[model samples]
Target: MRVGIIGFAGSGKTTIFNALAGIGGDVAPGKAGRINLREVQVPDARIDKLSLMYQPKKTIYASIQLADLPGQAPGSGGGFDANSIAKMREMDLLVIVARAFDNPYINAPIDPASEIGGMLAELLLADYTVVEKKVMRLRKEAAKGTERDLFEQLFATLEAEQWLSTLELSEQSLELLTGFRLLTLKPVLVVLNTPEDKADHDSASELIEPLSSFEAPIFALSAKLEAEIAELDPEEQLAFLAEIGIQGTARDRFIRAAYKSLDLISFFTVGEDEVRAWTVQRGANAQTSAGKIHTDLSKRFIRAEHMTCADLIELGSEAKVKEAGKFSLKGKEYITQDGDILHIRAS
Candidate 1:
């Protein structure tokens, strides 16, 4: 999975990216820089439990790649460079960092609602531009009597742009466009850069109201504070978070939110040699997900013994899980669940 961090200038987007990915990207004020890439480990409580149970020589977790691109400054520094927008179009999700913090030196003033609105409009406009140009070219070709399927698809795309531009689509219509990779249709996680002291303030409740209609989840965090906390030891960080009434680290929560936003789920392959987590989109089948590990594993064509991680933990071991009949044989067509542990038997 991939997520891109975007916003207007001085929204602490780079700071949030640094906090999550442990990269020291240039967070200097008003100094936009090149895109930074980081692979963040997917946070899973079940992985921690499996680590204790199996004590594998190598433990691996699924990762989501993040790209921190420079903010969109319309009418300045070559507004929305064609290259950069094209790069962002490949991302699986979007984390829009909106400025809500009170800081004098900020590159842009704090207007949380407007920043979000502007970002959404920018994405919509970008997608509309791409689709329009493509449709125009396709229209010329269709005039020469192209095949029916090809014409139908081109017209469908044209209609998508038409409908998305005019109507405020409900959640269902928005979901139907997921495969299109339309910039406006990507799942957005709005990160509010709030003051450290008022991390959980309810003042922004009204500000977040409009986002409800878009079906995007809103998260508030002090990016600077989170970056600082990330440098501390694990115990110290937990204590600090407790004192601040933060239930958990923003990095963890953000990672989780991004994972869920992409409609992805995790399944595990466990052993003393290695315990690894793999990610696949929701509704992915066993055979396709196995391909993620290796082509040979997926092609071997055999049944899998599947059991829940929770069942393994409760049963104390794989041996006990089998004795309790919690382990069941699943065919290649079986849909993997979020916390499934699979032991494949291939010929």
Candidate 2:
């Protein structure tokens, strides 16, 4: 799961990315294609619980890839170029950081409504350009099939200043356009880069009220404060947040929002040697998700012994779950559920 951080010029997107990345030193900008990518473990209570129960030598939580794509250069006239937009299309999710705090580069504070609207408008226009080019390349006779109809439909949506995400394409139709990565179709999380005084997430809500119309998950944070908190130890971080009257760190909530935005879920594999969480798209089948751990496991797949994590913990033991008939064998086509513990039996 990869997420790209994007915003207009002087949106403080890189600062937000550095805060979430929990890395030392600021990411130097102004270079083309210079991205700071890192894999950060997602904190999961279920994995923690299973780790204790199984006493694993090594425990691993699910991790998402976060990339700090350089923001639009100051005085670049806002919005991203084709090259920059291409980079964003590679992500499973997008974190759009909008400027809310006063900045030296920006003359005035950015209004949440205008910032979000402008950001989305750029995406819609980019996609529309792609659609138009596709149509122009097609011969008149070739522009009458289902493919042409799809392009026309997309053109209409983009022309209306609406996101393609609003349209629900069927699985087969979506697969047909696998060659094209539409910017508006990707899931998005909107982050308002606010001042330290507006660090509290709740108060930030009112700022994004106008953005409620968009499907993207919107939140606000002070990248500076989050970065400072990121530098502290876990214990000290919590204490600091409490001192400031904040509930939790932006990193945790940000991850959750990304997961929720796409309806993604996690399945676990636990043992005495290792207890690990794995991420998969919602409704992914057992066989498909097995590839997430190892491609060979998917090819040699047979059956999966599955049980819910909740069942194991509530029933007191794996033995009790089997005794209670809560444990079952699932075929390759069986849909994997969130919090499921899967043990694959490969040939």
Candidate 3:
């Protein structure tokens, strides 16, 4: 999935993006419409343990794609550039960085609440524009029925400055609105960029608590402090986190936030040849999830020999798990669970 990093100028989004992607993402100021894209592996200790146990020729971890966009201050006469808006439309999720720290270069007062609120308004305005234009065009054409009615309902919601996602729509209405790609409909994660002195994970709770109305995942970290450390190797990174007294790296926290916001889970496939982690929706069925591994597996799916990663680790082997009756064969309709190690049996 592609996630966009966005915020107003001097919010340190590039630093956050670099931290998340493990890259030196730098763009010269005053460059309009620039977007930097990078894909980073989603860190999971489960994959590490499985890799160690299997001694695989190769280990594969699921990755998330990130895009960092040029910072644009909201309420500016010129809103998001057409190109920037287009780029945002292509993203599956949005990460809005709000400034809570003082930056000497940024002249404006630091108000994360106002910054995020204004940015959300921008998104609402953008969507409202699209719906309004559509509704007007339909009226001009003397259009009536579900199509007009749907957008009319959307108009009322957007008119109130609420996200389109708040409206409950049928499958048909959802399909109809799919083409618009409303910005507010995308899952959002809010990150507060705070001063180094206040970098403690819980320090920004007050700032975040009031934002509960956004109904998005929220967290705080000092991007400037974490950016450089993100370049370190895994062992060194862990050492640094311990030294800094933070529970985890900024990247791991951000990944967890995104995963929770999206209701995602990872399943594994292990062998001597390869050990890989695959991400899927929480409640995806066995055959549906088999398609994440391979289409052929889903097409010819028989039954999956499923065992929990915890079971394997506890019992010390697949044989032991089977001996304990912890390994069972599940049919196509079986709901996939987190950390399930699946061996798909296909024709």
- Each model's lDDT comes to 0.77, 0.83, 0.85
Candidate 2 Cα deviation (angstroms), residue 195: 1.9
Which prediction has the highest lDDT against the true structure? 3
Candidates ranked by TM-score = 3, 2, 1
Evaluated at residue 40, the lDDT of candidate 1 is 91
Backbone clash count for every predicted candidate, in the order shown: 0, 0, 0
Runs off by more than 4 Å, candidate 2: 24-33, 73-78, 139-141
> Model 1, range 54-75, lDDT digits (tens) per residue?
9999999999998998786622
Put down candidate 3 lDDT per residue, 235-270, tens digits, no spaces: 997898798788887778889888888788999999
Q: Taking the tens digit of each residue's C-alpha lDDT, what string does model 2 give over 1-347?
A: 88998876567776777788886345444444567788888888898889889999999998989988866644345678777788888888888888778776566456656777677777788888998888766645576787888887888888888888889888877887777888888888899887888876677767667678877777888887888888898899999999999889888888888888878899999898999999999999999989999998899999999999999988878999999999999999999999999999899
Model 3 residue runs over 4 Å out of place are: 24-32, 74-77, 209-213
Clashing pairs in 2: none
Among the numbered candidates, top TM-score falls to 3
In model 1, the worst 10-residue window by lDDT is 145-154
